[model samples]
Target: MSTDRTDCLFCRIVAGDVPATVVATTDRAVAFRDIDPRAPLHVLVVPREHHPDVVALAAADPALLADVVALGRQVAEAEAGGQFRLVFNTGPEAGQSVEHVHGHVLGGTRLGWSPG
Candidate 1:
């Protein structure tokens, strides 16, 4: 897709160099199970191409940002049985482990404000 070794773990997953419990995959995105899930239905929706973060994506192509959001909602509604929350851990301070941009879809139960 994009250049390899984007200094992002999610990039590796997208490249298939790393293993992940993929839930769904598209030409532009990939949905996979979160390793450290905060809820019973926790999935990470990541773009096949690496973007530094949301801000970068917005500046590059705003419409692309919508794709990630839409896909996250689709995955959440489908897999969580109806409703869920979408989360994007943008930076290190926000608990983003991987540099590649991603949205976390959490549901399947009443998830509290603080992650469990």
Candidate 2:
């Protein structure tokens, strides 16, 4: 795959340049344990390619976006008790610390509506 960005953290993880506790991987997406997990089953699912956020990724590659969601679902089904929430924070203000597009699979507890 042609991972474009060198500075993107998720891209680095996908390229095997950075170390992460990877739990799942597909041709277009990867899932790993979050460093600071909010839920008991908090995993981060990211695309191999670099996109600023989910909206950018969806615009750039809708198929890859589908792969990301599927990968998240696969991980959540195996790890979380079949009931999980998928979250995509678009910007830093929205809690997206990394620039690369990613989704968070959260479960193993009751999730609040506010998403704090």
Q: For candidate 1, what is the TM-score?
A: 0.89
lDDT of 1 at 78: 84
Query: Model 2 off-target regions past 4 Å?
Result: none
> Tens-digit lDDT track for model 2 on 23-116?
9998778999999998999999998878889998888889999999999999988987688999999999999899888999999899888857
TM-score of each: 0.89, 0.93
lDDT of 2: 0.89
Checking candidate 2 for backbone clashes, the offending pairs are none
Inter-residue clash pairs, candidate 1 = none
Which 10 successive residues of model 1 have the least lDDT summed?
1-10
Relative to the true structure, how large is the alpha-carbon lDDT of every model? 0.82, 0.89
